[model samples]
Target: MKTPNAACPCWSGLAYEKCCQPLHKGGEAPTPEVLMRSRYSAYKLGLVDYIMKTTHPDGPRFQADTAAWKHDIEAFSKHTHFAGLQILSASEDKVMFRATLFANSQDVSYTEISVFRQHNGHWKYFSGAHLDP
Candidate 1:
């Protein structure tokens, strides 16, 4: 996990604390793009609880086996290097982004369009469709 003064993994050109740490600590993300960025940061940091909390209750991710999902997230965070993020588009309730990473010495990137909705006034990740880049 990045320290407060470290550069944010989300590639937001800001300190981790200023960029995504607040959201990891339960602060509200202002928009879907922000939420998507923070979720990427969470994956990089192995903040499984933050990930779970930010995922909408009705989402497929939330319906998975908790222990297994947490294990997978932790393993990915520890084994892969998060390289960058690109915000392709965003609206009030949706964001499309590309995430780049290096795993087993191979660089890879993927794109997804994620849907979000307010749950008790906080934005939560509802669903996503993978996209070809």
Candidate 2:
């Protein structure tokens, strides 16, 4: 759990309030990379509603069972350690990054290129393609 003044969980080098809080508080992320970093911070903070709201409904990863999906996300967030994030690249709609993590003291880090799409007027997480670490 991080306070508003604590370092951002996204490893953005900015405090939580200055970095992800605004986005969590209904501000829109201007780009996919920003949204992805905020999503990582959301995961670290266990902000499940933000995760749910930011996921693209039309994307393949959008789970229809809201209750189950929220539960799964909560479980993961509680059990996993969000160790670090490294942005590899960013285009107009895709952001590639490596998320270093640990679960049950076992390393579970991964690199991923996340895709985003604009739905209505806001950018939403669409999908992710995992890469070998």
Candidate 3:
């Protein structure tokens, strides 16, 4: 059952309505949670523009080539599914958390402590460190 409006279940721990839907629907979310969830949705949906829009300009890893990102995102989506997010700490513009990602299948997992920043009233991803499971 793949409907365009259906919420993705690849973690971020949010149902469609309470999570990425607002961002996808042209609403604003200020918290790291919202931004993170939306970013995960972006990955699932291949929304390169949304990823660019949410990414911090000042962040060290910001890449301007959206086309390249689009390709990378597509490749990632083919092998990845967001499992869930565990927020370790957060402030107005920063979030540190462990996100579990499923790849190949549920039998394989990837986890990371991702960092995010809020820029221009939106949440953007910057960098992250892999966590040991």
Candidate 4:
């Protein structure tokens, strides 16, 4: 668990309270890049509800089985180490990032370009294409 003054898990250099905390506490992200960073932080913090709520309902990643989906997310969050995040590029509706991660002492890092869509004027994660899979 992180204190309010600790650095954010998003690699944004800002305090958690100044950065992703607002997003996790029901504040809307103003841009796709911000949303993407916040999502990474949410995973680090095991905020399952935030991840589910920010996922686009019609997107490919959106599973109908909420219980199973939440369980999977929780399991992943528990096992994985969120090492770092680097934004490679970002457009109005897309963000490319390199997620540095480790699980079971094995490197599971990957570069992914993610798509976002506006749902009720707030950004929602739509899909992701791994560039290094």
lDDT value, candidate 4, whole model: 0.96
Report the Cα lDDT for residue 45, model 2.
89
Candidate 1: residue 96 Cα off by (Å): 0.8
Error of 3 at 68 (Å): 1.3
What TM-score does prediction 2 earn? 0.98
Weakest 10 consecutive residues, lDDT, candidate 3? 1-10
- Winner by lDDT between candidate 2 and candidate 1: 2
- 23-73: candidate 1 lDDT, tens digit per residue: 888788988888889989888888888888889998776856888978877
- Segments of candidate 3 deviating more than 4 angstroms: 1-14, 106-111
Q: Relative to the unseen true structure, what is the Cα RMSD of model 4?
A: 0.8
By TM-score, the candidates rank as: 4, 2, 1, 3
Model 4 lDDT per residue over 4-35, tens place: 99999999999999999999999999999999
Which residue runs does candidate 2 get wrong by more than 4 Å?
Answer: none
Model 1 earns a TM-score of 0.91
lDDT order, best first, reads 4, 2, 1, 3
Runs in model 1 lying further than 4 Å from the true structure:
none
State, as a TM-score between 0 and 1, how close model 3 is to the true structure: 0.72
